[model samples]
Target: MSTERRAPLDRKRVADTALKLLNDVGLDGLSLRAIARELDVKAPALYWHFKDKQALLDEMATEMYRRMVAGTALDPGDTWQERLRKSSHGLRGELRGYRDGAKVFSGSRFTGIEHAEQMEDTLRLFTAAGFTLAQAVRATATTYLYTLGFVTEEQGVEPLPDERREGYDVAERARRMSDFPLAARAGAEIFADYDRHFEEGLELVLAGIAVRFGGS
Candidate 1:
């Protein structure tokens, strides 16, 4: 074996490697051992950075959020509705970028305070748009939860943009639900054209927020 010095590892490097491995081994198969093997280090080396798998996952989720924020910029002149739409879509895009990405992101906490800045900005935007502080938090949470839940289900069907799991065939589903006439017909609408469906659902969520919170 060739003897070559390796770069020192940190939390960011560990989390970054784990994120890339996520696309291959997925969340279930990912572990500190696997990450350590990829990094050419002993598994114990990782413990210096992450206490356990959940800690590493939190860091990975934070990295994902950081990348999402870095890549997306909202227009300052846009109305609250427009900003919400853009932020929602941007989040969906980021979550869909990896296998089991939404799952990885769901329920994971940030390892640092980096996300607070974005949260502050979002709350400010909503409050500036005529919502009280409480209303702003609720409105933002509503949209965020909708996006998170939507993408989780979306990833369940298509883990990646071009890769769809088995058992979701529309015709097969329609046939399976034949006894329920309307439900049988609804299969196609529910299963196909994810982009259009996501947009329509997002619009509905936005509409509800507007009606309840009095935003433009």
Candidate 2:
């Protein structure tokens, strides 16, 4: 560590350092002490700005959301379905951008005003599509929960090396379960084309929403 003097620390500074440390060590390995050391400050000094590690993580989540939405430009003329699709795809991209991004977003208890306002905007879109306020909230929640769940699973998969992948026995299992017609045929394509898979799933969810409240 250099002996260079540092500027006074604030919540954003601490959270920014924590975010970098998160990239280096991942969500499981990130700790308050690690962030403090990364900032060249003592662990106790962090408490002045954040009550604890959770508070730091909340800020990190807020920053992550801020960055994710910074470049998003929603068109006023977009149909509600189009807007929702755009929002879902944009969110997925953001969650996959950083190491353990999904984990950090899911773990934090984000309470920022911006996040609340964003939620309100999404709900308004649903209501504008003809759903009641309660339905709008449920619709927005259902869409995002699906997005979060899908991305979490996507990120959890550790890609096998090309050589190692060839040794996997997925096809063999499908053959052994030949008695089950659907499983046998689908097994070969189970993990292929995730982007297509996610889109298809989203369409199913949106279709349900459309049927339930499209013109209500």
- The TM-score obtained by model 2 is 0.82
Model 1 weakest 10-residue run by lDDT: 74-83
Listed per candidate, the RMSD to the true structure in angstroms reads 1.4, 3.7
TM-scores, all candidates, are 0.95, 0.82
Predictions in order: lDDT: 0.88, 0.76
TM-score of 1: 0.95
25-61: candidate 1 lDDT, tens digit per residue: 8889999999999998999999999999999988989
Question: What's model 2's lDDT at 214?
Answer: 76
What's the lDDT for candidate 1?
0.88
Q: Which ten residues in a row have the lowest lDDT in candidate 2?
A: 158-167
Give residue 180's lDDT in candidate 2 (0 to 100): 96
Q: Per-residue lDDT for 119-199 in model 2, tens only?
A: 777667667768899888777778888988887776665221121234335677677888997987785565455588789
